[model samples]
Structure formats: C-alpha cells, structure tokens
Target chain A: MSYKLQFAELLPYWNVLLQGLIFTIVLTVVSTVAGIAVGTAGASARTFGPVWLGRIVAVYVELIRNTPFIVQLFFIFFGLPALGLKLSETTAAFLAMVINLGAYSTEIIRAGIEAVPKGHIEAGLSLAMTKWEVLRRIVLNQAFRKIYPALSSQIIIVMLGSAVVSQISAEDLTYAANFVASRNFRNFEVYLLAALAYLVLAMLTRSLLRALGRVIFKAR
Target chain B: MLQFSFWDILSNLLIATQWTIVLSLIAFVCGGIVGLALLFMRTSRIPALEWFTKVYIEFFQGTPLLMQLFLFFFGIALFGFEVSPWTAATLALTFWTSAFLTEVWRGCVESIPKGQWEASSSLALSYIEQMRYVILPQASRIAVAPTVGFSVQVIKGTALASIIGFVELTKAGTMLNNATFRPFLVYSLVALIYFCLCFPLSWWAKKIEGRLNVAR
Candidate 1:
C-alpha cells in the first residue's frame, strides 16, 4: 500500500475537533434528560391515562421505533419547513434526538412501570399518599431501579446515534471529522480519530450513567 | 423542468426499496456468518480469542455506525484500492451487524444452564461437537426472536449507507425531494416505506418473545 496514515496533519484542527466533541456531548446530555423526562411522562400516561391517550402514545412509539433515525431527522429538518415550522439545524437535530430517544425510552420505561407490582401502589396509597405521590415515590422509583440498566444502554445508544445529526450540519463530532477530512483530504485518519473519540465518549457516557443511577437509586 | 406525480414518487421509491432490502439481506447474512464465528470464539475456552472477541464487540458497539461507515468508505480507498460505496457500505454494515449479533447471541448462549456444558463434556464431546449438537441447538431456540428483532436494526443501519452515496431508499428520497421540492411528502413516504418493511418483523419478534416468555 502506497498510502501512509497522516494523523499528524489533523493536529492543527484539534480545536475544531474539541468543539465538535463538546457539542456532541452537549447534544447527548440535553437529549438524554429531555428524552427520559418525555419517556417517563409518556409511560405514566400510557399506564394510567385514558384509553385514547394510551393509543396515541402507542402509535407514536410504534412509528418512531419502526423507522430509522435518519428518516425522522430528515422529516424534521427538511420536511417540517413545508409545514411552516422551520427550525435551525441545531434545533432540528436536538428535536430529532429527543423525539427518537423519547419513543424508545417510553417503551423501555413502560416495561419497567408495568413490572411494578400492584401491591406497591396499594401500599403507598394506604400510607396516605396521593395518586401523584404514589406514582412519583413508589411506582417510578421502583420502575427506574428495575430498568436502569436498560435505560442506561438506550441512552448510550442515543448518544452514539447522535452521529447522524452531522448530516444536517449540526456540527457534532462526525461533522468535525468530515470538516477536517474535507480540509486536509485525510479522510481515513480523520474518521479513525473521530471513531476513537466516539468510543471514548460512549465509555464515559456509560460510566456517568451508571454513577447517576447509583446516586438516584441509592442503596443499590 | 420535469414534473413528478405522486404515483411517480411512490414508484421510484418502491424501486429504491428493493436495493435497501437486498443490501440488508446481504449484510444480515454475512454478518450472521461472521457473528457466528465470533460467538464461537467468545464461548471458546481460549483466553486470547475470548478477549479479542470481547474487544471487537465493545469497539463496534461503542462506536457510531456512521463513523464506521465513513472509516470503511475512506479507509479502503487509502490502501491503494478503488473502493466503491457498495463494497464499503456492505463491509461496514456487515461488521457492525456482526458485533451486535454476537453480543445478542452470546447472551442467549450464556443463558443456557452450565450443567448442559458439563454433561456434554462428560460425554466426551469436543467443544465443536458440544456446540454443534447440543449447545447451539438450545441457544438458537432462545436466539431466534432477538435475532429477528435485530434485523430491524440492520435495515435501519443500511440507511446510513445513503450518506456514503449509496443510492438506496433514503438517497432516492433525497433526490426526489430535490427534484420535486416536496420534502414533507417525499420523506413521509420514505418513512412509511421503512415502517412497512420493518413493522412486521418487529411485530413478529414481539409475538415470539411473548410466546417464549409464556413457555418459560
């Protein structure tokens, strides 16, 4: 092979790469929080809300789950403008990630919620807790404990999937690699670095999530 | 300027959908073969092979598929070989799918009782013999539903091939949208087509999973 790896050529673009890495982390963190919140709410509604509402949530989950993330991003970024709901590239990417993770986490959290025994809710209610309190204190707490590992995995998946955001010019880590590759014409080196960065990010995200889970679940 | 009727868009997308299906099948089949090899290495008693398989799965699972696609797409070209997007996408998706499938299948294999391995070895069966005759047969039963479930992911993974300039469903949708300036309609149809292709498989996986749980 005549081609030599030119990773050293990428050194000048370290700041660009750093900015992209930070942006990607920012995207992952924001989307993870908002997505899990949406998931928890959706799960609660499905488990306790009216039949019609449950059906609506089910349809939302199925539609999101069945299609690929890039399609959904395209629909939001390019398609939504037709409906007079134009958003900035970053906003569109963030929205897409939140919506995508929201759907999957809704299903994951729902599984946890359903596994919560009826006796636990009854016990909380008998202790003079309101329905909201029972759900918040007993149902969700136990459900989160049961599904924390699955939920954590989903969060990491979403973080990794955030690479697609670069397609819409959202300037995530993959975008940094693309930008640097275009500048230096070192596509292989740039992508290799970016991939390694992503591997590290995924590991960090996993560990952070595990620490957060430990803190939240307490006494685990 | 050329005009596109709704039927025209649908028909074009339908044509492109065939490539998506073909590409997915290739990736899944090739990945399954490689993943099976990895699964054996994972289950093998040799520390070196097991450790290598573990790192392989971790690297593939941890990195983004888009990045992997880019690596394959560009990495091959750098080696003084003329690389087509088809080869790149196929190779990337295959490795990506193999990583995930190996992990999924590993869980199923591990879920088999330890006593089965002990009893098989007590019968003087070789590792290959045990896996081929006894272990795989049982693990595969538990593996079927999840394997089918992962195919939805394989289909979805192929969409990233569009980014590398493979003219599959998503790429076709982009071209049509550019031509027609009807992003909402084109992308919606694109998403609908994917849902159609994927929903049935997921439904079947779920149904099989439910039956498995009931059986257990």
Candidate 2:
C-alpha cells in the first residue's frame, strides 16, 4: 500500500484539537478534585475510622489500584445497566476516573499523612484543637505541602488518562485524533501531532501545579 | 440480567491471568533492555542523544497508555505492516514502560554520592570500569525498592492489553460479563484476582523501602 502525506489536511481541525484539549483539562480538574476528596476520606478512614470501615476502604483502594481503569469503565458502562442503574457514558467515565484517581491519590496522600511528625499532632492537640481540627489544621496541611509534587505528577497522569474515556467514546484528544487520522488517512502524522499536543499539555499541567503549590503552600 | 455459572468464570479468570502475566513479562523484558539503553543515552556526553532521550521520556510519560495503545494498534497498521492485537499491545506497553523505567533508574544512578565517582577516578579506573565496579554497585542498591515499586505499574498496565482484544484478565472479565450478563460478579472476580496478584508485591516493595530507609 502506498501512502500520502497530509500535514495540510490536519490544519483545518484546530477547533477540534482545542476542544479535545479543553475536554482533557476539564476531565483532569474534575477527577483531581474528586479524587483528592475521596482519597482524603479513604486515608482518614484507614487511619482513624472504625476498624471495619478502615478495612473496607483499604480493600476499595487496592481493588481499584490493581485492576485497569478500562475494565472498571466497562463494568460501569455495560454491567450497571443490567442492574437497572443506567448512567450516561460520560457519567460512567467520570466515575471511573474518580475511583481510579482516588486509589492512587490515597497512596500518595497517605504517604504525606505518615510523613507528618507525631509531635505535630500532639502539639495541635495540646493547643486545644479537636481531633478533626488538628488533622485538618496541622497534619493534612503539612502533608499536602510535602506530597504536592507527587500529587501533581499523579494529576498529570490522570490528565492524560482522560484519553481512556475514548473507549466509551468520550471525544477527548486522542479520540479526536483517531477520527481525524481515519478521515484524513494520515494516521502517522495525526498521532504524532496528538502525542506532541499531549506532551505540551503534560508539561503545562506540571508547571501549573508547581505554581499552585507555591501559592497555596507559601510557608514552604 | 448478566448472569452465568460462577464456577466457569473461576476457570476462565485463572486462564486469562496467564495472558496478563505473559504480557507483563514481555513488556518488562523488552522494556528493561530498551530502558537501559535510554538511561545510558541520557547519561552520555552526546548532545543529540541527550535531546532524543529527553524527547522520548517526555513523549511517553506525557501521554496516557490507552492512547499509546490505540496509536500503536492503529498507527503501525498504517505503516504497511499488519499487526496482531498482541503485537500491538506488547509494542505499546513496552515503549511506555521503558521511558518510566529509564527515568527511575537514572534517578537511582544520580543519587549515588559524588565522592564514589571521585574516588574511582583517583584510583585510575576508566569511566567504564568506575561505573561497572563502583557506581553501579551502589546505584543498584538505590534502584531496588523503586524497581519493585514500578513492577506494580507494569502489572496493572497489562490490563490495558485487553482493550485491543488481547484476552487478559480484564478482557476475559468483559467477555464473560457480556455473555453471562453479570458485570458485578464478573468484574468483582476480576478485581479480586488482581488484588491477590498485586498485594504481595506491594507489601514486598514497602518492606524493601522500609529497609532502604533504615540503611540510609
């Protein structure tokens, strides 16, 4: 089979590329927020909650971490309907992203939690702070500051992971590239462009997270 | 409702796990060799090689493995080579794993104290001899915990192979779930098997890291 180079053909799809980038950014932000929330709860549960609750949360994180997100996506998309709980494909994808992100983030955040000195916790308690307040005002703040870099790295991973949403056909960047490449018959160039776009996006995410850490953790 | 005989799935999950193991091994073996080359290239004096290595690391580390899988499965087909699902998945996962491993190893190597290199130089060891005898022996210790930690990622990564119709545990679960019309049961079983596979390794990695902390 002979091939044709069509770099010019891809130029017209700039809007789609932009939309794909926005879609990816939106998914990453949503998942990052949701994942952090879930992870914090999971971490708390494992550390301070009732024994049964901690066990359950531990099991949840490990199961999610061990399995592939694609499988979890299919399970939500295809499996849940049989149980009469139908969700939009986007909703299912979003949920899968949150769950997947939560597991990895739990590990990262938990490391931060552990790194907080025991004396810090005692100092907060001695200052008359409630258990919850101490965990919030001292332990977690310090922990987050310390693990911010790893957390940012994980967020970048999740940002690119948004591409997997295409399995359910969420129309993210990679999905759009597949469409453009198939239509233009310039698969190699289209994918190369897509990869470059992703590389740029990842770097941008890293720099943005670094800046955010600087602003939020000014004590550092 | 998606339902099937429970026992049948047990056997299929077991069998499919073998494919997952096989895929992980292929990717690791191939990725290890490629990763070593990338680490060397990144450490080399050649500017072109250094730029190439950075571009490669950024490219792979930036993108999602799913996209990489899709790009490889479909992209390579456009190069006039008909590709099987296994061929596509192996190529993609191996490519992705190498970049991360290279960086991990590079960090381990760099973490070696500068004095060790200096001492080797003072002893009249050539650069190659220094690396083989002094630098590497030390770096290898630093690399252990992280290497084991990364294998968890490599193991989980094999599950993506299922997307291209490579029937690993995840793919098997999907197929079984579809035919049996039992998503929760099937995938729960799928998740359990993976937990069993991964938890031991996770515990081992943590143990090593704990020991490394003590040693340091």
Candidate 3:
C-alpha cells in the first residue's frame, strides 16, 4: 500500500486549524480555572464543612468520577434543553469540562488538604485569624503546594479529554481535523497533524502550569 | 409517531450496555497482555527497549483517546485493509489501556526493594525465573487494586467508541434521546447506569488500596 502524505493539501486550511486550536486553548483555560475553584471549594467542604454537606459533595464526586465524560457532556448539552434550559454548544462544552474536572480534582486536592497537619490550623487560629482566613491563607496555600504536581497532571488530563467536546460540534481542534479530513479525504494526515498539535499543547500546558506554580507558591 | 416510554428507553440502554461491557473486557484483557510485555521490556535493563516503551506510553497518555480512535479507524484503512468500527475501537482502546497499565505496573515493580533482584540473581535464577518466582508474585499483589481501578477507566474509555459509530451505552443514549426527544430522562438514566457499574469498582479499589496501605 503506497500512500503519500499530503500535508501540502492542508496549507489552504491553516486558518481553520488556528481557529480550532484557539478554541481548544480557550476551553482548557476557562475550564481549568473554574474547575480548580470548584474542586478547592468542594475539598474544603468535605474536609471542614458539615457532615451532610460532605456527604453531598461525596455523592457529586462519585457520580461524576464514575461516569464517562461524554455521557456527562451529552447530558448537559442535549438533556438540559429538555428541562427548559438551552445552552450553546460552546457553553455546554465549557460546563461539561468544568464539572468533570471539578469532580476529579476534588479528590486530588482533598488529599492535599487532608495532608495538612492539625497543628497548622491550630497555629492559624491561635494567631487571631478567622476560620475563613485560616483556610484561605494557611490551609489552601500548603494544600496547593503539596498537590500542585497532581493537580497539574489532572489539568493536562482534562485538556486531553477536551477533544471530546468536538463531538458536540464545539469546533475544537478535533472538529477541525474532522472538517479538513472530510473535505480533503486525508483522514490519516489530518488526524496525525491534530494529534501532534495536541501533544505539543499538552507539553506546553504542563510546563506553563509548572512555572505558574513556581511563581505562585514561591519555592524556597 | 414513534414512542419510547421510560422502560423502553431504559431497556434499550440496558441492552446497549452489554456492548460497553464487552468492549471494556476486550480492552482490559488484551491490554493486560500487551502491558505485561511492555513492562518486562521497560524493566529489562535494555536502553533501546526502555526508551521505546517510555515514548509509547507518553504518546498515548499525552493525546486524547478520541483522536486515537479517529486515527486508527481511518489510518488502518490506508494500509489496504477494511477497518470495521469494532476493530478500530478495540485496537485504539487496547493500545491506550496498555500504555496506562504498563506505567501503573512498572511503578509497582519498581517499588519492590533492590535486594529481591540481587538475591534472585545471586541464586543464579534466570531473569524469567526471577520474575516468576521472586519479583512478579510480589508485584502482582500490589498490582491488583490499581488494575481494578484502571478497569473503571477502560469502561469509561469505551464511551469514546461511540464517536466511531460503535453502538455502546453512550451511543445508545444519543439514539434514544433523538428518538424520544427526552434528553434529560435518557441521559440521567444513562449516567445512573454508569454510576452503578463504576462506583462499586471504584469503591472496591479504594477499599483494597486502604487495606494495602495499612498492611504496608
């Protein structure tokens, strides 16, 4: 089987790919920030909030963690409309990703939060810090430092998982590949390029997140 | 007008779930075999094989399963063979599963103390015999919980197979949602079914993991 690679066939479609890549990056950025916020908040609730709230958070984490992200995406994108809520494809994609990442990172950050010793909290309390202040300044800072590596990896995982958003026609990188391939009949070439793009994106995101961690946490 | 009651949507979903389970088992079993091979090569002290395995893992883990599925589904056809959705989905998922399981098991093997290998080598045990008698027995015990945990991932991964036109649970949900125009009910039921299948396995994995930690 002699198949020639025709990357040249894709030159006319560079702008399309760029648009898709931008969408992908934007989705990743928005979801990562919002997801981590939800995760951190849920972690604190599980760790320090009322028992019933903890149970509710536990249920949310379990339900999200156990199911497939595509199912969740479809549920939100298609199902929510039935309940009188209509969301754009991009909005649904964003919501699904945030919800998905939030659940997984809840477990990850909760582990970090649990690693904080009781004495640290006690110290913060003894220093005349309010409970909210102690959790924000002391517990959260230490927790983020302890779990940044795992959290960053989870973020990368979510970025990779974002390829499924194209399934709902959000026009992300994978959707661009589909568009170009269908037009040019270069399925193999198109997907290969898109996969490389994703590889580079994953590596770039990991390094960026690492650097961000260094800047924020200020490693001694 | 075509009609699907609650039970109709549910029973159809239950039937499609069979495909999901089957696809997951194929991936897990096939991937376990390939992953075990990769693990041996990775730990065999051979530089070329070790590097190759590492790159293989990174490539799979770094990219999304959806793209991999698309590639294999279309890529294999370039090699002058017909590519069925079943074969494509299974191949992509197997490779993906092998990469992750290899890494997981490699960690388990590496966690074993250095003395075990030395003791076995001093006794003139062949590498295979050493692995069989001294190394793998210990490592397999450590591997059980995580391997089961990874099964949940495999099950979830099968959902991506739907994009390639495999009639799995997620695909079934979409079809039902279209037919009944009851997206909320159909999808919620689908998520619940997945929850039932996966939550127990995840719980078991954590329970065993906790016990293993205590034992250690």
Kindly list the per-residue Cα lDDT of model 3 for residues A66-185, writing each as its tens digit: 999999999999888888899999999999999999999999999999999999999999999999999999999899899999999999999999999998899999999999988999
Question: Which 10-residue window of candidate 2 chain B scores lowest in summed lDDT?
Answer: B1-10
Among these predicted structures, which one has the highest lDDT?
1
How would you encode candidate 1's per-residue C-alpha lDDT over B160-198 as one tens digit per residue? 999999999999999999999999999999999999999
Fnat per candidate: 0.94, 0.58, 0.93
Best DockQ among the predictions, by candidate number: 1
CA deviation > 4 Å runs, candidate 1 = none
The model with the greatest TM-score is 1
- lDDT (10s digit) by residue, model 2, range A1-220: 8776567889998888778778877888888999999998888777778999988988888778766677778778877787889988779888989999999888888889998889999999999999999989998888898899999998988887777787778878877887887687777777778878888889988999888888998974
How many angstroms is residue B86 displaced in model 3 relative to the true structure, after the best TM-score fit? 0.2
Comparing 2 and 3 by TM-score, which wins? 3
lDDT of 1 at A113: 94
For candidate 2, what is the DockQ-based docking class? medium
lDDT of 1 at A28: 91
Tens-place lDDT per residue, model 1, A1-220, is: 5977878999999999999999999999999999999999999999999999999999999999999999999999999999999999999999999999999999999999999999999999999999999999999989989999999999889999999999999999999989999998999999999999999989988898899878887994
**iRMS of candidate 2, Å:** 2.3
